[model samples]
Target: MALMITDECINCDVCEPECPNHAISMGEEYYQIEPSKCTECVGHFDEPQCAMLCPVACIPVNPAHVETRETLMQKYVRLTQTAA
Candidate 1:
């Protein structure tokens, strides 16, 4: 599943740069995760970098964008291919 930044976020800015897929961004009030670009580090790291590094533990799985590991890997491949 993709991850989401909750309102509990302190906006400490630690999560943004750590996301390998560049899915996190500053929203109107806090950070937001773009579901389409979020693969939870499936192809890049064993854990989601943003979630793992968030000091406040505000990042959580996006229930609305639930997906399997294989699906996430497919998304990762597509993203990388597009970037290339």
Candidate 2:
């Protein structure tokens, strides 16, 4: 599943750089995760980097964009391929 940053985010500026996929960006209020670029860090790491590094622990699975591991892996593959 793609992860999302809740309003609880403190704008700590930590999560954005930790994301390998470059999916995290400054939103109107807080950092936002782009679901299209989010793979739960499947292709890059064993766990989500943003969630792991977030100081406030505000990142959470996006219930609106629930996806299986297979789907996330596919997304990772596609992203890598596109970047290449």
Candidate 3:
């Protein structure tokens, strides 16, 4: 599953750089996670980076966008792929 930022987020900008997929972004008052780009750290780390770095632990699994490991890995590859 992808990850999401909760209303508890402080928009400290600490989690942004920790994400390898660049999925974290600032919102009007809190940080947000792009579900399309969130891989749950499948390709780049042993665990979810945003959740790891979140001071308030606002990062949570996106129940609305459930995805299997295979799907997440495929998306990771697609996201990192570059033009030839």
Candidate 4:
């Protein structure tokens, strides 16, 4: 599942840079994670960078965009391939 930034986010600006997939961005009121680009760090790290780095623990799995580990890996591969 893609991780989501909740309203509890302090806008500390740390999570955005930590996201390996460039999925996190500054939204109108806080940080937002793009579901399409979020891979839960399956291809780049052992865990989600943004969630691990978020000081307030505002990042959580987006239940609305639920996906399996294999699916996330597939998305990561597609993203990397497109970037290459």
lDDT of each prediction vs. the true structure?
0.95, 0.94, 0.88, 0.93
Badly placed stretches (over 4 Å) of model 3 are none
Instruction: Give the poorly placed runs of model 1, Cα more than 4 Å off.
Output: none
Q: TM-score winner between 1 and 3, please give it.
A: 1
**Two-way lDDT contest, 2 vs 3, winner:** 2
The TM-score values for the models, in the order shown, are 0.98, 0.97, 0.92, 0.97
* Descending-lDDT candidate ranking: 1, 2, 4, 3
Best candidate according to TM-score: 1
Question: What's the lDDT for candidate 3?
Answer: 0.88
Q: Is candidate 1 or candidate 2 better by TM-score?
A: 1
* Distance from true location, Cα of 21 in model 3, Å: 1.1
Error of 1 at 19 (Å): 0.9
lDDT of 1 by residue, 19-71 (tens): 88899999999999999999999999999999989999989899999999999
For candidate 2, give the lDDT of residue 40.
96
What are the candidates' C-alpha RMSDs?
Answer: 0.5, 0.6, 1.4, 0.5
C-alpha-based local distance difference test score of model 4: 0.93
Candidate 4, superposed: residue stretches over 4 Å from native? none
